[model samples]
Target: MGEVKAIKGADWKLEIGGLTELMGEKEGPALLFDRIQDYPPGFRILTNVFRTQKRAALSLRLDPNLSGIDLLNGWRMKLRTFKPVPVSVVEGGPLFENSMSDGEIDLERFPAPIWHEMDGGRYLGTGCCVITRDPESGRVNVGTYRCMIQGKNKVSVKVNKGKGGRIAMEKYHQAGQPCPVAISLGQEPSLFLASMSPLSPEINEYEYAGWLQGAPFPVVPGPLTGLPLPATAEIVLEGEIPPLESKDLPKEGPFGEWYGYFADTTVGEVPLMVVKKVYYRNDPIILGVPPLKPPNHYVSVPLGAAALWDQLEQAGIPDVKGVWGFVYSAQTGPFTVIAIRQRYAGHSKQALLVASGARAGAYGGKFMVVVDDDVDITNPYDVIWAMSTRCNVREGVDLVKGVWTSPAEPAIPPASRSPRGYTMDRVLIDACRPYQWLDEFPQVNVFPKEYKRDLEKKWKL
Candidate 1:
């Protein structure tokens, strides 16, 4: 509902993704593409929907005026008040306007964009939620996983190991049954945000989305799979992932990842699903959220860091002023910074160590920096300045080996990677002034904000 720039005649090949990447780099408005090359006018694609804080705040139902760390802090506070608001089930809704089943299911009818030039194929679901229920617990999980269209009614879902959906799918496969799944290709913003959050396994994303919007999320059961589908979703697919041996799994990825690299593709590692049904509203829109290079994140703010902030407090780290991350998504990434009011001699280091191992901060992390409260962790220049001025490399830096990481880590040699797990090293930097010499530490050289304001007012020159 924010700034939308509607355009026409963009090819689904590189044109659409190229424009989306270009607009994101410019920090422009959300793009709505219509009259795509070789497609009818009604099949649309929306991209760059969260390129600004104001837009992200609106989607999260928070104060739109907030920005930077204040916006993230507002979300952190809102998360503290979270209580499950169950979804509302309805008999039917707009999502059923068009339906196809079995032989009639043709995924190519929709506009799936080849987001990156070297991407293995056209990704049908990026800003999409893949819904799967745990076979044992029976608790449903909604998560965002890249889905690449492979055939008329087939797509490869890259649900990584240890993810909720992957774990649930494995459970069903082990029991010798195909894992039932329903994917919403485009839905309400709140649901999309919830799907992308780093929630605990016990938390249901639908209930979380309801809480985010301050009302019940409306859903309709998928006629084929019985999974709850967003009543107002633009497009929905009901399918099942069958048990496939390593040799049977399909190749997936080589798509650009959040870390700004086209990681190697799997030969036969990603799960492939056969779509049993397809449903869509008239004039359906696909939410395309292709990953761009660093600094141009999928979301404007480092939202995942909010979860880490809470994790630090839960771990009993005192005086944490704020937390921020660069190249971050779902709370894990390459660089993270924690601002704190150093309380003891080892306070900064303790914060660093705990954060480097905490569930919310450990995964896929590379550089962990801790700074005094005076340093603004959200600003790269400020954080780097603190590290340069305050850190004594020999005394302030520490490296932890074989830490938790993701498969997308470009630095991990392919030969070293194994199906069992992946690990990477972490560099922790204490940017806070030496606590023992607090009384004698050199003060920062900068003009006070109030002093500068008063000077500007007096010198109306």
Candidate 2:
């Protein structure tokens, strides 16, 4: 349950060999490989930090039962009293255990796993954050865009349209300057979570990570780009994005996404990075968690749901009990379900409208379901039952068409790609007992607590 602070370089081979075996056996522990082939033996790598709910809870220093939303809300509440104390520079950290210069860089040496067969290449920066700057504002940005190892020093970066990274790149493009960027490969779990957190466009994620960690994160200004990065990061790559050219298209994904299928794409392309420098600790351990179908604990949907809840609450939506973004649907397309304690007539409808209009909802979500507070939104069966029995589809469903959609979404039609959103048919189910005639509905049967306990004891024989 404790974090591995550092590992010795000489012991790296044993650690990697052991970790590789453990990963194959599905054993539990954060694998920190001190070394991999070609790199100095002391470089560190981490994996399986978010493999289970318990692990995620532990990482956040929360009770096991606390959901990501609960943790986020608790952290948000502390924000009023918390302050970020940025670390400018320090004497040394694990990341500086070994450093490589321009000519010494070799990306293939790291144990960057070939996670999924369909992935375009070994993703070197899946669990990392790409730090960039807004050329005009001089404001820094951090994004969780995935990166694929392209060469000895280069990696392909996928910055989705409308994402902060892409916008920053656009700013650089407009200025006719190569975008200054730094890619951080590994660091504290809090930083990774903050990277994925849906913060205000103006909020620096580094500051947010500091708030969550209960202290300002230790950061070092990137050597070349000057972007703040996790000081303890395993690997840091300082680079620039060249003005995007028409012929720079690199075949990108066929990676199995959260939707349980290979993400559909005929022309998969993203911006490419020509590495100017690559730095690492001696034996660097690259973290890689390939997206699969639902139940991938590190999957983006659940995290997105937590962000959605925060956004909905911020929008003054009342009685919003919970939110669940279907991980299975994210790969297929974005679908979300929200649970609320309906306060009055049309409350559910109002909730639906606000959620659908939210920034995250408009970006990827295709379907939304609003259910009464009693229905556990996380339980698909409960949500389905509510939709089936309580909803009168014709009366309850509301559709909004021509909504804004992200270009990365596969379901979006080409003709409607001009900031256009598709229709979202919202089904509001009043799972609560009918207010006018509560007694008319049949009472649900359940075993008495004492009787169930007795039965369980007797069945042991």
Candidate 3:
């Protein structure tokens, strides 16, 4: 955000769709107006924090031009050795420059933007991280979940089933207890990155943030919840998620998701957190990151790609070259691509099965394509070309059903949907040449080096 600001950031006009509604639909890096209207000026809004891979890399202190696999691989390597530095408590940082506690909690007074036109309500936790604790292990969990304001001190939240935050909350439900939680906004980018990362269960995201920035992720305890929070955060809301019956739960969405579509207005009745305490800097900034569509994968793709690639390698899938959950699907769903140098008859299939069956690919996965090393998984055109010529639909396609997916899948039969989970069909396209034809595959058409050089000199085309 500072980098973009230094370059005199561009203005993004708000119209019928609302201030942040059209942000996800844009294609390139344009750090636009975060706080446009329906809010005060002292409180700012930081939008498009991770809209492009270039900005993402620069925000993480990587080369400004670093992108795709290079950017992802660099972070993946650092993630392997995340020795999390314990959060240190201090008087407080910028986060506690002001205060709102006890009966002072006021949701409407905050500059929370109503992003999309079709959203159920104003969302406050779009770019924030929710902190909770495991009932059994007491391990701290930080997750990014959609939070919608209900009343003055109330907000509803829904988390994906397989998420660590959900798991922690479920543990509380099992014990018949309310879960304590803290949601932080306008915090350090490293903290947000770690919260969104697909890290191993054993690794805490705080440590992951430390590894990302080569320093500890400074934090202080929430006054009400005692959960750690980014010390320099712009605002903090501490509350408890009380386990409630269906009739007592709160409705959360109808908001635009990362997939650019609104499948279900509400995931289900979710627990509402009653804010008991609030802390903020003098003129707080609300970190707004509303999910809209494709270009939004600046967060999902690079990290998701590297995490899936690492998992495949750990599973002993040899000859693997690259993997990506294309931005077209927000890094989830059927568009996952894996590039491999097929070494044997069924080597490619083995890679396919592991990738499809793994937790990462288990949800919203529709089409998983296995391409040869010569094809670039990052390039959709390259992947499509390989699919066109190297694969025969009848012989190369493999179908796998009963694969787990989010209930938000629009194509799922409504009768088959359940609050527990849902299943999506998956197809593997073996976009590689026939392994039997070892020596006789047709060579790709290309100009010879001298001919290309001469053509380059003679024509600007």
Give the alpha carbon lDDT tens digit for every residue of 1-461 in model 1: 54899989999999999999999998899999999999999999999899888898888888999999999999999999999999999989999999999999889999999999899898999999999999888899999999998899999998888789999999999999999999999999999999998899888999999999999999988888888899999999999998988898777878988899998588778889999999999999999988889888889998889999999999999999999998887874889999999888899999999999988888889999999998888889999999999999989999999887888889999799776668999999999999999889987789998999999999973
Give me the runs in candidate 2 sitting further than 4 Å from their true place: 1-45, 65-88, 264-268, 299-301, 328-333, 405-410, 413-442, 445-461
Question: How much is 231 displaced in model 3, in angstroms?
Answer: 1.1
Angstrom error of the Cα, residue 339, model 1: value is: 0.3
Best by TM-score: 1
Comparing 1 and 3 on TM-score, the stronger one: 1
Question: How are the candidates ranked when ordered by TM-score, highest leading?
Answer: 1, 3, 2
Report lDDT (CA) for all predictions. 0.91, 0.65, 0.74
Candidate 3 regions with alpha-carbon error over 4 angstroms: 1-38, 296-301, 328-332, 448-461
lDDT of 2 at 9: 49
Position 252, candidate 1: lDDT: 83
Q: Estimate TM-scores for all models.
A: 0.98, 0.82, 0.90
**Preferred candidate (lDDT higher): 2 or 3:** 3
What lDDT would candidate 2 get against the real structure? 0.65
Reference-based lDDT, residue 376, model 3: 73
Worst 10 residues of 3 by lDDT: 5-14
Local lDDT at 60 for model 3: 73
